[model samples]
Target: MQLFPKTTTFTLFCAFLTLIHAYDVVREYSGVSFFDEWDFFGSWDNLTLGDVYWLDKSDAFSQGLAYVNSVGNAIIKVDNMHSVQSPQKRNSVRITTKDSYAVGSLWIFDLVHIPYGCSVWPAVWSLGGSTWPEGGEIDIMEAINLMPSNQMALHTTSGCFHNYTPPNQLGATLVTDCSTAAGCTVGELQPNSYGSGFAAMGGGVFATQFDVAGIFTWFWSRPNIPSSVTQSNSTSGIDISQWGPPSASYLAAGQCNITEFFTPQQLILDITLCGNWAGLPEVYFPSCGNRGPTGICYNDNVVGDGSNYNDAYFEIPYVRAYTTGGVAPTPTATPFEIVSKVDISTYPGYGSVTIPLSAVTATNTKLQPSQMFFPGNGASQRISWLQIGVGWWMTSIGVIILIELL
Candidate 1:
């Protein structure tokens, strides 16, 4: 009278557990099809006030600002051929992913080169809300003016602070408050993590895991990329438990509420010439040397012939997004308008403002597989209890049916 035999029940339970643990490919933006997954930002420079004009899709391809190279890598570069006079911005490209990703996901960026040079500010980051820092912003890979290493940061509303740091993190914590202007930042301690040194090392992989527990970022040079990531494809799902310690770790246990502060994040990639962060005299002069007679970031580095930007381009192999069998909400592509007022007094020496973009619609939509499952070992085992509870419920229902028949 039993509904299922012991062996059958055990096998079913195991299958369910496998589904929960598996990391399936949600999206793969790579090769020639890379441009199809993203939308080019066409408006004028408003947010960062970078001295560069963002190109549309047609213009980007026509002018060769964005294209697929011979080796199948996606090349998104600043204009190195054109000379720009004063009062005109240089030509560059900024792209945002059509799809947005929430928590319980992993993002892997495989690259061959990263933009770097004097007055060249490049970022591979994500923005959640239309309003700045309210939804949240995750700076996965960002630096300016020939920086030696990359900086990972988290920008959120007030009250969120990094109370705990993962023991295995390889980066140095520069800021602890996850505030709007100067978000909690972690600087990579590894050599050749950014700029010319990173390109010379044959580029590498930057993987970010967003879970309920917290956010984690890992960096691997080309030669040292783990087999779990390098060997992973769309078919064979990746297991984060196999990957070792991350380069940067932001734990959300007691401090930040991952679901509240963070939303479905849209991936963004851009090269801005001397905006707020890189344009400041205090920021540019120290790292990039004195500004000479021009005495300004735009005049010193952004003007004249575009030879300085030859190194300012991104040579990416692919960008992959993975989820653990969770159904995320369908995202609407909302166009945001930048606010005209600029506040330069907030960041002190950094010369950056807060809340430059107006608020778009905010949603509290939740995705499944939403537990804190990361670092693979302890966290993975912790999530098994949920599976066990489900298995027990099924067994109990089977016994009740058998008893009723008897």
Candidate 2:
């Protein structure tokens, strides 16, 4: 009798700690919802992509350049016909999420396709609230020309750097010191990680987990994503614990303070051509060396010649934000008991289920819910007795005796 009471007290204590550590989905954007969550940013100019065309809020929709497709997917596309003829100018789209994500948040993006072409530079990045480098920038996806893989970069004030050993060697760290001048960069080594190869494989999902430990990113090919992600209709109920090791882990122990370096940031997705990174004579000329006399020139060959831009577009399925230790919505259900036996074997399997304990007064659906045991917590926690009733003392002992027989 004492053993049962002791175990119950211990389990409740563990559950309370677990609940405090878990991340909860606070906001989710998918399909048509994505368009509503983001706004077209047209005030800036891209000197890198040359004197090009950027569609404003009104022009992007009215001109048929950017909008939600028939199936409710967000589409940001470029004009191939106009781009080819006007060598000096090419039309493109840039948009930013309306809300900013704070420190210690996880962002997940499901993409069906990404922009890829000879003169194109497309990116999905996050910017801090402060000016350029002071606030920090996390480039989730950035590619130039026909690059084989994506490049993830961090642009920050002078002090920040990539000090952590990567969990795996999937990407090569191009730079370590994260300064505005060069910025720290890591290039994906996987062949089909970006550009045409990524589109050929049908695009994929990218996740960024930003917390105090450091920033981490993971990518999954279309076919290999977790079932929870593919089947998740809402951000709630999707757990990141099920996902294995991340491809890129940037924890520097105590060397870098992420909170100090990064501020609240807005997400961005855009495509531009033949400027800065891609348009550099050294970068573009080498990629298009085979184009000979007619192929390499900026205005005539790359954009003016109207290089095919049929693939210069992004097809986004969803983008969501989950935060650990964030405010949870008011839970409706009050505490109730629904206990079942937990396995005692060395190989733990505490057959636990989440079922509502009905009551006339309960307004919320979830009722005193808790996991029997979290895997990897420990083996000693898997043994317990069944207890279900109006009060623990009134019916638990009877149910425990009956459960032992059945």
Candidate 3:
């Protein structure tokens, strides 16, 4: 009786502590949200105090967003004027450093986006601090008009670029694999034949979890996924530690990954059209705020020096995070269900059940029957449609459990 009570008692106490720590941990994960909602400019030092942070754009604030001017190609004096509606919307900053992290443990980024368009180059990505090709860079979502498709990539000296095709296209492609000295790339489409249509349905969330194991995975859902809703959806971890460091990256390792160097990573919401990446040709701007994408658009002598960086940008509703000692619910263990459904109503199966397979795969991981999925009996009247998807199992053994798909 005491053991049960004792454990319950201890668990309750831990629960209380978790409640108190939840906000703090949550703050670490939601660094970008806090930065957006609050005025954290110039108070960089104060931000470090509570893990809540914001950037100081030594200029004016506009449309409840930050706007900075070109100090020249790379450097710019930032302002709080967030202009640009859609077309690669959002601006971003880093939080990790070479010294320490904001939480000193693990972190999860739950990103929500508006939608996509041509002139839009919206994305959620990360750059390593230590050394180029060594520290690492993660491209979460990058889609433009030229390539109106979603892609996730890992950039490191240790690994090549691994990307995901929009949806429906399958088979991983890579001439070589990424290593400390080399890297590789892989891509595929989604299972459903939907062309980013669900994204417009709103509440699309893409999550990335960086861990100690050489594994870092990526996941996406039209809406926020309940912990582990689908095992087949989680991306395979890409090992990048072997690269040593990525000093050549935009942000040095000390500033890129070390929390001590920067606040929780800053969230960017921009939709720039035809700049460096999209191959937008040069324009002869008669003056500031007068430039437009390609072809010749009439230019007029604009008034203010403000609209200097006129480009596309996206819109977001909310951004939150989860870390140790925070106010949010401690992230529960999300169970993943790799659903390999076979419409036996059309084709019977005691053999391999052919489901619509179009997720990303790599060279090391073969796309050929990587594993046979046996749904047993998909249409059992008494069994219902409940036990009809792929179940979980130890990598060494076979799978166990059958979940109903309806």
Candidate 4:
């Protein structure tokens, strides 16, 4: 006998399809509450060998290296007041999201300012793994010294390449190989995409969408931001397709398998001085000329009085993460309360402790931390099917299989 009347079976099938179609896209991170969602990178040893020291939570806020401005914006900055002798790194701030995100999501950064100055290397990027190049690094927004425009890049293992270009991309592809050292880089064509020019335009929004199809990045100045993005909040969702042409695009259709090369990425924001990239003579001399008394990146900009770093601070209003298929839980205003610290001393350079999810007391909020990769840890965080927003589709498939057996 049939499992049920034909009409009943048809109704069940339709309900399953409806559930699959009812996925709601929502913001995973909201503006102004960024400090509550992110954590201070406690490592003092600069991984990039930058001429700066990374501050822990207590020191960052106590020293005023990181704090929320009176205007309700988050400010993570370098010490622009104190002078230090040679061989000593300046105090700086580096922070990352407590949660790591896999693909199939869009990340939007709304900013009023970005760190800049000679010897300054600031980036708003994402890292997939702890090991360099293997986990993949997405440079959503990065530039060195007094760069006139922004640079976007993807640093991955061998085999990934940017052979195909998306239509109407505004940036120029500077590199084709998506390998470690020379990551596939794209230079933004807009002069106002970085530095003083960007700040003059009242800063803007930089959006990066990682999907099965490709990785795309777009930039919109304050006055030109799309209504769809500006109006989106934690409860509401954003429509990236309606945002128009992206500034940069890296297609993964044939050239690379994004799923294989990219891991669950954690968002990172930091400003380092005279690092490997910014300190190189080839990079520093061309733009900044011979600077300071010693005519060196570290001696000139990083040493002596920190007068050169007046602009070296990130003033962000909010950063939002959106994913399709699942309804976003409403975020509570409850501040992140650290109940305990996890000693991650085993991880080299990350000898300090961090507030893990289990240490958080807020159980009713969605802003709680997720599985993450501690500093220097090489293991990749696996993304589950539910995290991919395919739970409904999986249920639908199970129903079909059950009906076949019946």
Best by lDDT: 1
Candidate 3, lDDT over the whole model: 0.28
State which candidate has the highest TM-score.
1
Superposed by TM-score, candidate 1 places the C-alpha of residue 145 at a distance from the truth, in angstroms, of: 0.3
Query: lDDT tens digits, residues 1-406, model 1?
Result: 5566766766665554444445667678888898997888875567777899889989999999999999989999999999899888999998888777767788999989999988888889888755666678888998888567787888888888775776677776767888856588777767777888899999999988877778888888898798888888756687565466777788877888888889878788988988877877777776665644666889887788889789999999899987653322211223123222222222232213322333223222111112233213465556545545655775565555445444
| Tens digit per residue, CA lDDT, model 2, 176-227 | 7776444676666555667766887888998887776777776777876888
Clash pairs, model 1 backbone: none
Off by over 4 Å in 1: 1-21, 326-406
TM-score for candidate 2, residues paired by index = 0.73
What's the CA RMSD for each of the models? 10.8, 16.5, 18.8, 12.6
**Better structure of 1 and 3 per lDDT:** 1
Alpha-carbon lDDT, every model: 0.74, 0.61, 0.28, 0.70
In model 4, which regions exceed 4 Å deviation?
Answer: 1-32, 326-369, 372-406
| Alpha-carbon deviation at 263 in model 4, angstroms | 1.0
lDDT of 4 by residue, 173-248 (tens): 7677787464787777655777897899999999887766678888887888988878866566555444666777
- Candidates, ranked, lDDT: 1, 4, 2, 3
Model 2 spans with C-alpha error above 4 angstroms: 1-21, 47-51, 83-87, 292-297, 300-302, 305-307, 326-406
| Tens-digit per-residue lDDT, 1-406, candidate 3 | 2323545555555444433322212232222333333222332212111111123333323323343223211111211144433222223222221112232123333433332332233445443332233344454455433232344444454323233222221213331323322122222133211124434544344444432212233344454343332222222221211212111111222212322222223223323332233322221222112334423211111112224323222333333333322122222233333243212222111111111112111121111111101111343222322322211112111211111110
Descending-TM-score candidate ranking: 1, 4, 2, 3
Collision count for each candidate, in order: 0, 4, 81, 0
